[model samples]
Target: MSMIQTNDFDHVNLIEKVIENNYMTYFNYDEFTNKLEFENSISSANWNIIQNNLLINITDSENIENIIDKLIDHLIKLHDEFGYGFAGVKQIIEQNIQYINQPLLNNILDWLIKNQISSKYIFFHGFLYFNGII
Candidate 1:
């Protein structure tokens, strides 16, 4: 599919492609999204946590600011309460698995920052440097 249309970014379609490609992007979006979906299928609570905490809806009228801030707040709270960072997030995602997807963790941070989810990371210094969200 086309990457752009009408001089604007097609985020929804981009996300779909990212998931579909599932190659060596910032973190295998396909794997993670599918894993999350599967995990949710088994337990509504798990799904709800992810859906409510980190989920983003691509639409013209969406108030992304609120969701972004909420997600950052969630991460910050986790850090403040449990000292969680990439490791903690990885642990949550992988669950019983031995290995952790570092890229996925990085992507989460990148997503938060790139989307203005966190005001502190709002600067666009690494527009091309980042692998995930760009």
Candidate 2:
């Protein structure tokens, strides 16, 4: 197993650095890549590394913009790559709505509308209503 999988090594800083540098970083990627991996890129796998290794240990002192924004960017890229095959990204967005600010949420929802996915329009309407943003 790699040092990252063993959890005995100090990989937090390394992971954080990777996240700041590339929002598309994934544990499965053998190298830091600038392009999105269509076959292996799933929201759950990416989120696993971030949520388990990085966010869980974050302190209040940490500037979380890079981490959150990177994940958001990654998800958006995934949408761009796969189009309607967005169930994974949708789940991530729904669960993370509370963590993101209104502007970022607007960006995400706007992208969804631009895609013209009927279900997403219905979904975001409910999201806005339930979150008291309507």
TM-score of each: 0.28, 0.24
Off by over 4 Å in 1: 1-62, 90-119, 123-134
State candidate 1's TM-score.
0.28
Residue 128, candidate 1: alpha-carbon lDDT: 20
What lDDT score is found at residue 41 in candidate 2? 38
* Whole-model Cα lDDT of every candidate shown, in order: 0.39, 0.46
lDDT of 1 at 127: 24
**Top TM-score hit:** 1
lDDT tens digits, residue span 53-88, model 2: 221222334344443345445555646753423444
Clashing pairs for model 2 are none
Residue 95, candidate 2: Cα error in Å is: 6.8
